[model samples]
Target: MGIDYRGLRDPNAEYTMRDLAAESMGVTADRGGGRDVEITDVQTTMVDGNFPWTLVRVYTDAGIVGTGEAYWGAGAPELIERMAPFLVGENPLDIDRLTEHLIQRMSGEGSIGGVTVTAISGIEIALHDITGKILEVPAYQLLGGKYRDAVRVYCDCHTETEGGAGPPDGKPTGEDPPAADPIAVAEEAERVVSDLGYDALKFDLDVPSGHEKDRANRHLRNAEIAHKKAIVEAVTEAVGHRADVAFDCHWSFSGDSAKRLARALEQYDVWWLEDPVPPENHDVQREVTRSTSTPIAAGENVYRTHGQRRLLEEGAVDIVAPDLPKVGGMRETVKIADLADLYYVPVAMHNVSSPVATVASVHVGAAISNALAVEFHSYELDWWDDLVSETVIEEGYIEVPEQPGLGVTLDMDAVEAHMVEGEELFDEV
Candidate 1:
């Protein structure tokens, strides 16, 4: 005799007798809980944003679809296609198990850390969206609820005169040299802070200083250090206490030079110096962090929790900046934040994705207690928020959605208008 699922229903349980009857008949009831919904298909498309925004969609038998994005890269969409078969017929709610399965199954393809993991990260985020919608809760609630109603956002501003040149042979053109004007940088910073209302801002500090003799050696000359210092001073002085200012080096300097640059900005109330040295060597990164009073931030290049272990364990970074779409998805980023919190480090997400991943990152930032801010890299992209149905950021902050799943709907028209050339659109469900 088969056990009756109807008898298992409790008076206070969410599902009613009618819902249980539907489940016994293999029908999906209201709120998607009656019957098991399997993954029917996975699709991908690219949006030509600041980067090629790789968008993913996971379809279910119940007709519910979940959307996500991978960090912009060449191979992510293809890798998602390669992994789709394994997810077919599996329950989307089993997110952790499926993520681990993909990590192990694709271990040979460098899933331990790189494009493969980025692909899996995209799928994992889609799963969370599905699970949250089915469970009738917001995505941050699926990640263990939220700590705040809104997440602070930091804008990335570019100065008018910040430009450099390189030759076709991969050599520095030396002709253009770095011409980051302190005055122009300050003007832009003031406009973004005062006019745009961003309390946190970042400026690029890794441009040609017009004083480099050997660019490949990754050494900063005294003149180069002075030039960078001037820009930092001008921006910080321009913003004053109204906004906190950070600078990014893009990991383009050697250890000694990175330390020198960090020391030069110590006198100012700098937010942090980002990715001062290469990510491959944690010891050198740690040495640079310990060398100066200015806080050092990194980790956008790293992949999963294991990839971020040494950086937090050895105090390599004073602030952790994980790109959610790139760093093993949402849950993994929260785990990384929990690990950082144990060591008293804060999180600042490094983001350059579309409003899709930006909203996804906001949910993660809302869930984590130690979150500092989420980076907004597309302020210049006039149509960045048009890709979604709702306004993502307002007054330099993202309000956490109370609606189930990601809450924001993709504007198909905007997506079609900005779709990357030659890429196929998602099939109509």
Candidate 2:
């Protein structure tokens, strides 16, 4: 049987941009669909646990729906709900246009780099999912084909036993009680590497309880720095040549102190030193990066490509870790990676969401040549992958799906089972 390319155009007869722009743009009928898939409704729900997981779903007139998750936050669901009206009648396939429209529409709402962008990011991801499903392609293809089939994943792990002791909120903690000291941290690293098969891993280096100095001053006492170094040294030494280890300071130190800490940890040969200093001042970050042999990675808290562009253009950090769902979704993430590519920088996705966003990051990770690895923060949460129909990540890599959209349908049962108290699933729509 011969291939019927036109059969692949938007199945809905109610829409037809194909006649005008399809052939001229070299958009084969199979790949030119979804442009007419109009948004019918937008809805959000929250899941209670470590953080309030804000999930976004964009329903289209074509019966195709896309799901995305805003990075965990207080106003994410409300923010998405507020922006839903603007998106109601627009085309989910006009991803870039819709993204800009939302940005412009909410400009006065303080969307520069906060919950506003997170809301937009969730919506943007859903749009890509819709467009991909409509066109029968993967989300990465929408970003321009792919460079790799499997994206490496890094776990944001910890060694602390209890709350207020480990990586803190927004990061995962498990029932496997925390180990005692640096030795325990090493044991955790060994288990993660040997048992879990994750070649790259990260742990927090600046947990308050681990250090002795005052948190307000941004200055690190010698003992505090030494304690931080001990953690790094133990983890790296334990994993020795088996896995690459990274440490996160979470923007806890002053520039000078951060540099000193970075310089001190140089002997450990860490994979990357993350957010040693705060992210506000690029010059200071750049100075810290230049001062240390350990690679500096930052920008997870940054909102969109614009924020990352500033850091990349200034050579602020060695590696940029954009939280894909939080950093303006798939397209913006690809844009950020492309911009970083020009500067010969690599991208390490800062992920903390469930499988929906994990797979979304996999798509972006597949498309970018310099993508180092994507974070997997749900190792301890057994139900994390249950939220989706199938497990998207196994071992330490995501096998990019050829199936359309984000390639995973929401297991509503799993979602409902985890819903936050007093929250209804997509009830607003």
Candidate 3:
């Protein structure tokens, strides 16, 4: 515990130097984008319900390739295809320049809902990756400098809950449904914390596993609190000591209900109460923070600093979780965190998807001073890492790869193998 900072991994791990990358830099410029690169191919997949992901592989007139994920929902393909005219022959690496251009292009476009921004996010990420590769620095260095050598992780463990993150591929092989009973949940938390080396365990305490509708069974407000308390007791007894316990209200409880529930659950030593009130009410958030000794956290649905200004300024919660993809790109997210850090609030990113997003998130988390942890949900996804070929993460930490760029190489073959049928851009757009 005595700042074991001396003598760690070799700082000079052999990698192609920046000069080497610069020498070979624009190799992809042949396929480079500006406003001229055509979005020749777009692939989309629904990785279970609500887990839709899309990969936009922009092919430049120069014949180089850059990939990005505009995935949030089914809208990814449409967004990419719709913006095709603008992106087809353009430079994918000029993210800021292009974003500025595209913002006007997309202005007055649509609601900029789950789809449009997701598309923009995909393009930004790919450009960043390409730029990183060109520079030969791990993406983290480009975003200033890394704050930590490795990122700490926490598991939502919702996959095991009844309706946790959706039914497990609907092919029940007797997996026992992720220990929904509080005692069993506590046991699982203990295993993940004591054994798995996770610093935090955030249980889905808002509703019973598998049933969103069952939350109504509580009948009265007191019953709801009692039910929540019982669930907390079951797991708190199981997680035992040391590991932090937190609850994600999932925006289920209103302001009053949220504060009441936070107070009730405090006895079990909850670490932070998350998203209890909806993201809209700043005053509600302030009230919740003032009402409870248990810390508060939110901002997953919050966007760029423009979106996060009021919440962070008001000191609404103890921690802030920016959905790296959902929020604006890395630069904007860093700005949001800087504002929060001024208030001494920390960050815990919300990433519960495939490895692509995970790797991008790791770079940002590694670079930020106030980052608490990167949400490690998909490490349990068996074939997940096989999709991306890189050593971006190791053991319980995100190992900053010596490789240039985002440090993640997509195994196209693996992606093709898992490619859901009929997803190939068989037709135009």
Candidate 4:
């Protein structure tokens, strides 16, 4: 192929920018077994799950379609639609180059962070799926191959009345909901371990403690800390060594309060304390992590590897939990893992997406050497696994798919049944 260098600078360039850039990078048509394929269209649909799951599909001229899920947000679907024109006619096999092209092209839309990157992340993931299918390999193989056949999952458990332990009439019955009582919480934890066969679980500690005078200050009262500690003690005692219990604070406390809470939980064999302080201040996060023997996990709020680099460099967290879809797709997450590995920090993917993105996280968990566990956030949602053809997580682990691309096919019937109110299903291929 002859290079037309002036076309690259032309405003009315006939060649797509991606093709020009690929040629400039010496990416030949012979790459990925010389197969020629071009992206035809990109489509998105929202499935209302625990969080609204934004599903993305990239269609090709060859009739092969790749499916992916973006981290849900208000403008994600619109952003993906706007980006579709940039991807059309580009080879799906040049995954990295094309991902960067999208990022650079959409920088005005905040590609460095937020919904723009989330949308691009979905497109990047679909490219991986399509490329893997084109090469007749699993998605994990495209991400530097797998280190494990199955990825262990940690369930994010919740009580029946988590937000408020009150009755339907807003009347305080004599009986409080299980979420408010330590024994009830412990009993639920025991049930999840004994019956569900999960070895790892996470519960929220940022629940209403009833001792708060002001929540905007992010300060936790002594009674609040004591109540949280009681829950931790009870649950840890109930589960014992059968399962590792982690507590999530969701970045809801002050540095002093988080330090106190961490100190209180040091008696038990807690798995980790997640996001004790706001993620913006790395120094505060580092101080909190260094103050306690309990493992500290953070990073779900940030964007690409750049957003996570400071946390790792400053030893802010023991575990780095980057949501694959929210963070910059699979390859960017691999880069994050590689950086965390340098500091010996384990990668525990913070996932709240549907089976599509959950399976995508499993592929990433398989590829990275520092993977600890991928989160299963939808255990309470009965129809979560039904979104896909095969069961995504079985016995608390997702068996790395040996089939091409993401392996499991979407069950369109289930998706159509659960589609968001205003969204339309993907057109038939």
Q: Highest lDDT: give the candidate number.
A: 1
Q: Write the per-residue lDDT of candidate 1 for residues 1-429, one digit (tens) a residue.
A: 433342233334565564666667776653225346878899999999989999999999888899999999999999999888777766788789789878877888999888998899899989988888888999999889899999999999996588862332346543664577899999999999988989999999987566767767788899999999999999999999999899998888899999999999999989999999989999999999999999999999998999899999999999999999999999999999999999999999999999888888999999999999999999999999999999888999999988888888889889989999998888887
TM-score of each: 0.91, 0.87, 0.79, 0.92
Q: What are the lDDT figures for the candidates, one per model?
A: 0.88, 0.82, 0.65, 0.87
lDDT of 2 at 291: 91
RMSD of 2: 7.2
Span of ten consecutive residues with least summed lDDT in model 4? 3-12
Instruction: After the best TM-score superposition of candidate 1, give how far the Cα of residue 326 lies from its true spot, in angstroms.
Output: 0.6
282-350 per-residue lDDT for model 2 (tens digits):
889889999988899999977788888878998888999999878888888888998999999999999
Report the Cα RMSD per candidate. 6.4, 7.2, 11.3, 4.1
Q: Model 4 over residues 250-311: C-alpha lDDT tens digits?
A: 88889999999999999999999999999899999999999999899999999999999999
How good is model 4 by TM-score?
0.92
- Total clashes for model 4: 0
Task: Give candidate 3's error at residue 83 in angstroms.
Answer: 2.0
Stronger candidate by lDDT (2 vs 4): 4
